[model samples]
Target: MPVLISGSVAYDRIMDFPGKFVDHILPDKIHKLNVSFGLEKLSVNFGGTAGNIAYSLSLLGEQPYVVSQVGTDFSSYRKWMKRQGIHTDTIRVVKTDVCPTAHIITDLDDNQIAGFHFGAMKYSAIQATVVKHKVQKLVKTKGAIGLLAAGNLDDLLQLAKLYTLKKVRYIVDPGQQLVWLTAQHLRTALAGADTLIVNDYEMDLVLKKIATTLPKLTARIPRIIVTRGSKGAYWYYGKKRLTMPVAKPKRVLDPTGAGDAYRAGVIMGMLDNWDPALTGRVAALCATYAIEQYGTQRHAFSRQQFKQRFYQTFKQQVSL
Candidate 1:
């Protein structure tokens, strides 16, 4: 079975700042606040929730089908994907003139400020209108798994419904877009997903908004994975709470896309049918690597290297 990655594809423009962000802000300014810092350098990389996940999966030797839209400027990004052995045939082009883009700035302390322009990403809603046909065509040979990463709100809801209608196993990962969804809309998206992956902050918000217990929140969904920054991750399913320790990072450069990297590890684990404990450890290791690099796609390691890291961190051999 092929894993379908449905979400945004864009260029990530990263800027490096030499000074701490706190140096420019005044606490005694009362209500006035204005500041700007000169950037030391700028680097562009192929990234987006979908692209990041697909890239991570490729490192693990999984070829995920990315079904998303790109703008006219996607030439280089497309080239990179093909070269990386990711399945890009399903990628569509937006009718617009430019592709989606994310601008991020990281300070000396590794704090980040990011802004996203949904350029080509906006076309995802239109793509959702015909996604059933797309799904049908792709799954003709075997069942396909889906991970609905962050994108247009309506597309998220529609794709969730379509996946449920077809009974395709899927993971719902709203990411930062969770803020754009209403409680009712969130419930709709969660109704039939095989699993829901959210960070600790999002988990707290979802619980508050949905007004439900941990057990009740996951009643319809089989599993809910909550990631806590340095503490590690937790999985709630079938009246039990499971925990996985963190894979210590070599160095923390940027935490921008660690969550997506973790999700890629989770998908890989699912494909291999690994135990929950093993899956969580794999995800934690992926995240550890993600934070060690400035850009999401910059984290790369061979299977042998990853296996060695896994054993060193968890004191157990890779079973998958």
Candidate 2:
């Protein structure tokens, strides 16, 4: 059974500003003012929710099948991912459109402002190739696990239902689209998911609208992980809650895709049938790895390196 990754595929342009953004804005005229700041340096990288997760998973020895849409210009990236052992047979190429692009600006304080152009991603709603491939794969494989990271809410929900009926254990990490999901759709996805991962603020919002006790709510779903930046992460499996502390890195470089890295680690540990404590520790270690790197996908690791770091931080041996 293959690990299927479903999400958006986009080019990320990261820019750094020399000064603090607070100095440029006046509190009283905030709503009425329009301003622009020049960036000091810019770097472009291949990224998106699913791509980041799959990259980390590949590093951990899991070959994941990525179901996403990209433009014709993505050939180079596809070849690169293939070399990394990621299966991209299900990725649809939009010949007439450009790939999705995200422009992110980060200030000295690590705050970010971003604008996105959907481009090829806009056609993702109408693409049947990726969805058909995923459905066929699900039907043919037993005990497959799918990660639904990005896409149109309707499409994700429908696919979630289809995969659930086919008996695939799946995790849903709805990154930024949580705000757009309807109450009914959210409930349906949550109910269908084997695991649900989200950050602290998103967890609070979900708790407010879901109207159920967290413990009881998670009983139906096998695992729930809520990440808190520096403090670490919380994992709830039914009534059992395991809190893992964050591993302090020698340096904090970029916080761009740390969450996705953490998700990948958790999935890797789960696949190994490790206990929740070990699982959370694996996630914490992966997060620290990303924190110490400038770009999201620039970090590289050997299995020995991961094991050494894991034991140093958690004081436990990870038996492979």
Candidate 3:
């Protein structure tokens, strides 16, 4: 089944800080604070919510379509996606602008600070709407799944509306954009979603913004997945809550794109209708692989290797 992934496509300039973030700044001086850290390592890689998730889905044997807008410098990323067998026909090219770029710095303790330039991502809504016919056709594809990840807020809402009208199952992932999305916008984006995925911090923000508790939110959202970094994730459906533990990794090189990988795993499980607990474990294991690699799309694993690791880590066998 093809997955329609809508979000930003960017170049991630990732760097590593040698020390912990907390060691540098004082809480009392937090207001009007100015600080800089000397980076120990830096590397630029292909990333963005859509690209990262689609890359992992490709590894899982899904030819997902990336619905996004890229800048003139997208040739390299286009080649990379072709190599991974990902579909880019829906990705609009903005000839006048440069691609979106994110400068992410991670500390030794895994805390991160990022500076993002919207660049061509700002035109996402325009591009998406202009290609409505193609998008609608894909939405009607048999067994196709839709993922509205973080990107231009307008584009996210637009895609949500289309998905609902087409009666396609979709997941809403309001990540960094949570800070900018208004209550009404959030409601619109999640109105008809099958699942809502966010980190623990973003979960709290959502509840606060909507002035609703978890129990109340789940009554309407059907399912919700709250990822807690090292603590794993919590899956809430109806009145039941499942706590999932992390899949231990051999080494934690970087945690930049782990969440996107987890989302891909969730989509895989959803496509197969796997049990929630099992799906979460698969998602956790997928995230572990991201942390083991330096960049989001750098990890590679065959189905056999993934299955072997699945058994080794969780002591359970999985077909994929």
Candidate 4:
């Protein structure tokens, strides 16, 4: 089955501040505070919800078709993705605007403060010819998995409905975009998804909002994964709930794209028809790999290496 990835494609400007942000700000000063801190380090990398997930999935030998909007400046990034074996035919490039850019400043504790300049990404609502063509191809292929990271709400909902009507399995990983969705809209989009993956905070927020409206929606979904950073994740499949431990890493580098990597691992597990417990463990292992890398897409591992790590950590052979 083909993997279709949909979300943002942007450049990440990562900056590291030397000290904790809380040290400089007074709690009582609140709105009257203005401060600037010197950045100890700065670097640029290829990132964004869809790009990260697609890159990780590609590492697992899945050629994911990324459907996202970029700008004229995306040529270099596009070339890199192609070299990585990710299908970029569905990625749209806006000729008149600059690519999306994320300015992220991380403090000593790894807490981040970010500002996003949407640029060409704001035009993501427009349907691209390339995306339509790719979707048509997937329809012909049948049984493709649609992975939605973040995108135009209307477009995502429409695509989800279309995929469900076409019998295509899909996984929804909304990330920060969940804050923008209404309860009813969330229900509609999730109803068609084969799996819903979100961080712990996001899951709590979603559950709180939907509990009053569609109380049974969560139970009706095939699977729901709540990722809890270093604490690991919780996987819900019908009446059973499995808690997976985080894989202990020898060193920590960057946690920026760990969640995306985990999402890819879960998708890989599902494609392999693994159960929820095994899927969560695999996802946790993927996150550990990401945590050991400086940049989101810089990590690479052979299937054998991954299996060895999995067995050493979880004490179980990965089922094919």
Candidate 5:
């Protein structure tokens, strides 16, 4: 089975701020706030929703295709993806611009502020046009799953339309891009999707924007997953809803890419046709690995190790 991950492919420049962000800000001056925090360290890593998900899936023994647009400065990231055994032939390269880059600052409380440069990612429709044939080919494969993660609004909508036309199963994760998506855009992107994944806040935003209740939304979409950091996640399918607790991590280093890692786990479970309960557990465990590392694509573990940790965390055996 192949996984088609369509999203941005960018570099994550992460900086660590030693103090809490709230301590330095005045509540009343929020409208005219001016503050700067000295960073402790800065590290540049290969990231982006598509890249991160593909990397984690590859680690789990799935060679997922990354459908994205990158720029001239993407050679290093391309090489890195190849090293990880991910498929990148569908990634289009723009010779004129630089690859998209995300500048992120994280406080001691694991809170983050990020700014992303669209760069080559803005040409997502062009990339989608170029890779239509390749994507269709992959969609024909048995048990192929398409993941529409955070990226250019046009790219998400285009991919969703294509997936629906091809009758392929897919998951829609609006993520940070939800801010820019109108009710109509959200509806269009999520149409015919097999599942919808979002954090608690994002889920709320979606409901508010769409002017619909969870039950009403679930009536259309087969499944909806809302993740709560530290607390756990909720899965809504049909008339039933299931809750899953977070897997305890060895140490929480950074929470930047945990959601992407969790998504890979979810896709893996979907491919295996595992029980939803077990799948949610697997997803939570995968997220634990991500929070334990500072960078998104830095986590690594063998199948055996993953299974062992699953048992340790949830007291249930899992075969990955």
Candidate 6:
């Protein structure tokens, strides 16, 4: 069975600002502020929640099928995906549009700012037609085991509903897309999920929006893994709770797509039937590698190397 991933596929345009942003802007003149900072350099990288997760999963020896959309300019990115061994049969191409792009600028102090152009991603609502086709096909053929990552709120929710009706199990990850959803939609997404993954800030918002405690939410969802950057992660398995400590990397370079890497580990762990501690620890190690690279998909590894890192960090052999 293919592990299905439903999310966005975007290009990341990164820029470097040689100086601090605080030097040019005055807080006192906040109401009427207009300033420009010349960037020292610009680099483009492949990313997006689905792409990043699939990249990490491929490295983990599981090439998940990506249910996403790209644009007319996706030729290069399609080639890149092929080179990385990612299965793209389910990706829809909007031939008249350009792929969505994330514009990001980071100062010397590591402070960053970002702007997003939805482009093809804005038409994510149109993805339902394709998803319906794919889902029907999957049901007729192999069973569906999937990941509902960040994407169009309606699209994600509808797919979740469809999968539920079909008795297909999937993981729900709201990522930053949680802001685009409503309390009702949020609750719908959480119901019947095999696991729910979100960062701390997202988790707080979800909890507040739903008017429920973490324990209560976990009672329905089976598992909730809340990730904290440097502190690592927290896992709530039904009524039981577990803490996952940070796994040290050789070095830290960028924070982009670390969450996606962790989700990939979670998917692998769920498939392997590993315990929550082992799952989160393996996820932490995966995230450590993500932070060591400038681009989300640039990090590379093999099972041997991952097992070695796992043992080095936890002092336990990776029997899973």
Cα deviation at 146, candidate 3, in Å, is: 0.5
Tell me how far the alpha carbon of residue 4 in candidate 1 is from the true structure, in angstroms, after superposition.
Answer: 0.7
lDDT for model 1 comes to: 0.84
Candidate 6: tens digits of C-alpha lDDT, residues 168-198: 7788998878887888898788666878888
Total backbone collisions for each predicted model = 0, 0, 0, 0, 0, 0
Give the worst 10-residue stretch by lDDT in candidate 5: 124-133
lDDT of 3 by residue, 97-185 (tens): 98999999999888999999999998864355556667778878888789999897777998899888888889999889899999999
The TM-score of candidate 1 is 0.92
In candidate 3, how many Å is residue 78 off? 0.4
Query: What CA root-mean-square deviation does each model show from the true structure?
Result: 2.2, 2.0, 1.2, 1.9, 1.2, 2.3
Off by over 4 Å in 6: 18-29, 107-111, 125-131, 139-143
State the TM-score for model 5.
0.97
Candidate 5 yields a Cα-based lDDT of: 0.89
Name the lDDT value of residue 286 in candidate 1: 92
Q: Is candidate 2 or candidate 4 better by TM-score?
A: 4
The digit string of per-residue lDDT tens for model 4 on 192-262 reads 78888888889878887777422365567888888888887878777777788999987987788899999
| Residue 41 shift from truth in candidate 1, angstroms | 3.5
lDDT of 1 by residue, 1-320 (tens): 78988888888999988989888778898379877879988888889999999999888888898878888898888888988889877677766657789999889887777899989777664354365466567654456788999976666787788778778778999888888778898888887799999989899888877777777876767889999889988898968889878998889987888998999899987888888998999999999999999888998998899998899999988853
Cα lDDT of model 2 by residue, 1-320, tens digit: 68888887788898988888899989999998887899888899988777888999988888888877788789878987998899887777889997788888888888888888877776653257656765576546866788888665555776687777877778888878777776787787876788889898988777776766677777888888889899898888788888888887879878888988998988887688877778888888888898788777888898889898888877898864
10 residues in a row with least lDDT, candidate 2: 122-131
Kindly give the stretch of ten consecutive residues in candidate 4 with the minimal lDDT sum.
210-219
Candidate 2 wrongly placed segments (more than 4 Å) = 125-127, 211-216
Q: Rate the local accuracy (lDDT) of all candidates.
A: 0.84, 0.81, 0.91, 0.82, 0.89, 0.82
Candidate 5 per-residue lDDT over residues 181-200, each given as its tens digit: 99999988888899999989
